[model samples]
Target: MLGIVLPAIITAFSLLILDWLLPGITIDTVTASVLAAVSIGIVNGVVKPIIQLLSLPLTFVTFGLFSLLVNGFCLWLSSAFVPGFEVRGLVGFLVGPIALSFLSTTFGHYLLEGRTPASLPEA
Candidate 1:
């Protein structure tokens, strides 16, 4: 489905960019990037919700900013399962997810716009 595949691709692109931009985030190859992207997608889909729920009070106290930390944790967790996808140190753990989130969101919005029904006017 486009819904799933598109996000994965976007995440991969984001990872590639992060690999280039950040010294702490190292993706060894294109294959590694794709694998990391898929791993991150899975983590975000499955694990992130549980984390959000468990940290609901903290999220509320932080006025939803704690969700960013949750995202970073998910990214760090994905790196552990993905070979050749290394996130070094605390900085990588924190910034990688935020960068990936921004890139994926931007690319998904731009790329999927034409495929979405909202792009079409009512009959």
Candidate 2:
């Protein structure tokens, strides 16, 4: 389906972009990037919400800044399951996810602009 495939491709492409920009982030091959992308999506979808729920108090105490740790943990955990994809150090842990988020948003917006329902003509 376009819905699933599009986001996965975007995530993979965003990982490749991060690999290029961040020294601490290394994706050995295109396959690794794609695998990592799927892994990240799965982790974010399944694990992130539980972690977020558990960390609700901290998240509130930190004024939502605690989400950085949750996001970074999800990224790191996903990397552990995928070979040839490595996120190293604090920069990779924190900044990699941050950069990935930004790149994914920007790329997805431009690439998916015309595909959105708002662009469809009224029936």
Candidate 3:
């Protein structure tokens, strides 16, 4: 779907930028970026639901704030297997989701979707 692929590309590029900006985080090439993106999608699709289900009580107790930890864990897990994509230490791992989300949203709005429609015609 256009929605999914667009955001994925944004996340991949954001990871690349983060690697350049942040030491100990490295996304070496475009190939690595693609791999990291795919791995992230798989982890989010397959692992996240199970994690959320298991952590439901904690999620409720923390007012859903602990969900961020799950996102961080998934990011770390995806990075572990992807070559040339390395996120060292807790800072990179924890901030990964936030950075990706921010970048993806910005990129999606500005570059991918190309601004909101000014008007809609009647069907």
Candidate 4:
């Protein structure tokens, strides 16, 4: 439960940050941000695998980098369904996913996973 819920909340926070930093991403309200975050998680879990299977050839050709485009498309699709959340233009589609990925990874590693400087052994 914590594993699933925590990541979703973290993703919401990342979305909020992205909304603040990027003009292309708009999250109108707190409720919308939460909805959008859940939507993205659903899309990633349900839709992404199907898309990946279909795009396997392209993914292979691109050395797996094409997965990023798939991820961006999922984020864009979630925005379309959420009224107050909007990702505008091609730049938004591209940057939104990348920024979300970066923030989510950082949050998961350092925050959610409970890794801290004090926990590390000194060399």
Best by TM-score: 2
For candidate 1, the per-residue lDDT at 33 reads 94
Summarize candidate 4's per-residue lDDT along 15-40 as a digit string, tens digits.
99999998889999988999999999
- Compute each candidate's TM-score over C-alphas: 0.86, 0.92, 0.83, 0.86
The lDDT of each candidate is 0.85, 0.91, 0.81, 0.88
> Which parts of model 4 are misplaced by more than 4 Å?
114-123
Query: Tens-digit lDDT track for model 3 on 7-123?
Result: 678778888888877664689899899889889989999999999999999999999989999988988889899988887777777777878878767876777456443332223
lDDT of 2 by residue, 28-120 (tens): 999999999999999999999999999999999999999999999999999999999999999899999999999988998898885774554
- Output the TM-score of candidate 3: 0.83
For model 2, the superposed segments whose C-alpha errors exceed 4 Å read: 117-123
How should the candidates be ordered by lDDT, best one leading?
2, 4, 1, 3
Please provide, for model 1 over 38-115, each residue's C-alpha lDDT reduced to its tens digit, 9 standing for 90 to 100. 998799889999999999999999999998789888888999999999988777878878877788889888987756
Question: Could you tell me the C-alpha RMSD of candidate 3 in Å?
Answer: 4.4
After aligning candidate 1 to the native by TM-score, how far in Å is the CA of 81 from where it should be? 0.5
Give the runs in model 3 whose Cα sits over 4 Å from its true position: 1-4, 114-123
lDDT-superior candidate, 2 or 3: 2
Sliding window of 10 residues with minimal summed lDDT for model 2:
114-123
